[model samples]
Target: MAYENLNFKKAHMTFDEGYFYMFDDGWDTLLQRLADGGTAFSYPLSDTIDSAVTSLEYDGINFWTLQDPGAGTITIRRWQVENSICWLKNTLNFSTFDSDTFTVEHYHTSLAATASGGTTDIQSASYGTVITSGTVLTLGPNSSSQYEDVTVSSISGTNMVLVSGTQNAYDSGDEINFYNNLWIFNNDGSGSLHKINARTGANITTYSDSEYDNITACTFARVSNVTSSTVDALIYSKATNLKYLNVNTMSLYDTMTMDNLKVNNTTIIVIYDIAIAGNTIYRLQKEAKYYGGDYSWTYYNYVLSTVRRFIDTVSISAYPTILPNNAVNVSEITTIVNDQYGDGVVNKPVSFTDTDSVGFITINPAYTDLFFGTGEAISYYKAGIVVATVTITATATQYD
Candidate 1:
């Protein structure tokens, strides 16, 4: 690799060796150049527009102005709305002169709404107050004792008709009406419109009536699906309209009614691979074995005997043995006591002897031998044979 090292002695270097000299004076110019490139454009020092640019000009297509603060200083301000001018004068404290000329530019307008009768045909009613579009109207000073009344007669496309009246209540219903739907307020504080189904008599599913009283300020409840085999049941709440109550069993189910099934709370068991759809769940009791005896195992079955049966059926014949052939013998040793005052009394000491046969037996490896050998003799001998003996002596008395 070829490299060149150039050194400068002056603080500022002029273009010399066919390359421009970039001097770093502890400013961001070097940082910016290193970030992007040496030929990158530098950012502007100030972004505020000059305040002296004036002399408005209309170029037939657009209007603009340039302000000159004499001596070549210049500023440019755009012509905005009158509110913007007021804001600039009052809020921003911009200096204004009477010589500044305001120019108006020509634009295009359309009469589509007037020609199509889209905006003119729609009428308005009172919502208790008189108001107009694009025009402001103040409230109060009405003779009918009504605060404000403005009514919207119809709404079409992007246009609407509204009217104001002094009377609080109108002789006719609201000018606007929803054609297909009606609102109902439930007594339980919930309100909704019955869309898919209609209510009739005690049977809420029937749609026979054309003019049923509107269910306003009434409790709204859910009724589940009902079937001929079983009556629908409502699980909670007294509102029968919204819930499914089993007429036969008096049991309750949710909106989606189900066949009334008897639920035995005590007999309800949990079994594997079983699920509770409504009020029913089931379970199975299991059995197991230890030492080839039946043992009650709760919930699930753990079949040790089945495992043994499986082992027997297999070709593998090696069975697990828990104990050795030799039986473990446990003996208790006792010391005999003689009674003196209990009728049976003797002068000489009596001796008691006990002998226990201890042994082990094992089957021959050939599986032919039944009995092996006799056990060794175990004996216990007392000190002497005695009928009665009593000895008592007082030692010391201690006070507590």
Candidate 2:
């Protein structure tokens, strides 16, 4: 095997379809072919356009970036790529720029709504906090000719009241784009992380915790391919902190800590940036040591199980289903959980039950194994148990 080492400046990254893109030195855009690691291209943007790009995101159609143009305000621009050339489509000048606001995420909710013509109300679980009165929303961007913009007159419990009425009918699962509702964050040393809904200019939620005091970088991640509650955000603090924040709940779902390799017993690890592709997370890290003031930067990637692979098929193991009525005889009943792709799903909860209380299972809620996704429970039909044939059922719980 052969290898090559190259140096690249720290930059922002995004992925669309099958191609990966990044901005090196905040100015040069590079596209790499993931299949063969060949066919690479680089295009450097002029300083007149924007001095530095703080954040970059691709939403399967256009590339969006937040830039610092040596001015007091921040500029958000959208670009379209044609024949490997990027053409600027639109630009938005935004004030109140903060240094901590260095990441931008293009958000597409897995939610859809249905409404009839002249309907004055829309119901959704997402209108809890951010979708309030006076919030204008653009509905049904699913096609070129099927959309209407409406303003919220008031909020009644969980329903949103429009200022006027719908102009056309909308079906369920239709795109409800609230003006490209992008997800961005602001960490102002308040020990609170504010998730801003760029569409309505309202905050989605504020997660108050000391763990997020030093947050420096974040990116959106996909949890599953399901239509509802599928997106999460990965946040990184300057300290040794990494966590997954559920977008809907505004709470921490999981935390991760990576160990640093010790060379001189004095090493500091810093996670620079993070990006997600499917279930894989790519992280750029810097390790600094006091020995001769040595430091090195490296890129690391890890694969995680995010999609909740349901039980496509369940089968009993080689254990005997028929057991003797003797008290000393024990029947080890095992159930296996397999996904539609015929792969084992680990750590899923499996419960064992019998009909009419004929037998008792030792482990009621056993978890699937890491090896074969199989859970075992001891089923005993002893002397007091009936001799009639009983059915044993195993149920697996889906997890995300």
Candidate 3:
């Protein structure tokens, strides 16, 4: 009902949790503002600090700083590391821990996913091997190798003691293997990415671990809570690109060029920070403009990039378990996809199938996709043509 607009020189910006932190070159202060603009506070970081903070990224707590031109350095600082959300980053791939003795029931390859959703701590399959200490387990999707490794310190029964450190957990149906290999990538002509064993510190420079050429700062922008074969990230070069890093394949899944938006009116720049919280992809942008001899700047916070919601459950409209062979197109079988909010999803791919081959199942893409379709059409065969208990099923393929 009411609004207020605050304008200040934006030298750097970051967003995490639900707050927007802004900094200016002149004032050695950090402006911590609530995302909704309900409240804000400013604290002194020293004029040197404010100007040096060319760009910043916040993971709800603490700051990952990308300094401006004069001081080309990447630094992370916060109140405290132990209680901070730094553990919830893509750079540090550690998993949920319940106890010291956890068993690696199975190793799911990235390619062939054996586990489905909701089945955690238990793999669909199990490894029968009785191992010793120092054996590293690479866990994730088998085909992708976009996995995390856990080194064993000792073993008892079927359980093993993981080398105490920060490690991410793997889930069921994920590909698990006996290796601690990681394809570390840097701009090395020796290699674009190196296939190195994290445990042994052995680097294979010629393995060609990454497809991202001439790019740096390969950090992750986590969207979904699940860790599998992919990591979402904003990779910058001549242009800002959205890249999916498949840890399984040890390469980039795909690259999408993000269309730039002009912010400062004087000039526009690439997005500086990105995060996927729930179904929304959020971005923070920055630009600099030289006024007189002094530089003026602009920063846009919490820009909605895109909304990608997944199907939590599929809702089926009223349908008959037993359809008469002679029944006409009187009844329609509809498919519905719902997110966690119990609302029908849009543009999500759904397929319809009926076991009774004698009848036809017509899918209403226009209606069903829009979440308000009349449903589906079911035309059963005329009497005495063929009789079978028709099992009509509707399933979701993807979320748009």
Alpha-carbon local distance difference test for all models: 0.22, 0.54, 0.42
Candidate 1 weakest lDDT stretch, 10 residues: 305-314
Clashing residue pairs in all predictions, respectively, total 57, 0, 29
**Per-model TM against the reference:** 0.13, 0.50, 0.39
Q: 1-400, model 2: which lDDT tens digit per residue?
A: 1121122344455655655565554455544434233436765443235355656666545666766554456666666565666767666665544433334433343223677889997765453455667766667644445666688888766577889998987776665534334544444455555555554445566666665554555666555532235554644544544556666566766554433334554454545455567755454444433334445545322212233335656676525556666644556766767664355667777776666354566677777786644433223323225676666678888765
Q: Candidate 3, overall lDDT? A: 0.42
Q: Residues 96-131, candidate 3, lDDT per residue (tens digit)?
A: 111100001112232122333232222224332424
Predicted model with the maximum TM-score: 2
In angstroms, the error of model 1 at 289 is 48
lDDT-based ranking: 2, 3, 1
Better of 2 and 3 by TM-score: 2
Give residue 31's error in model 1 in angstroms.
Answer: 78
Off by over 4 Å in 1: 1-147, 157-159, 164-400
C-alpha RMSD of each candidate structure in angstroms = 40.2, 11.7, 16.3
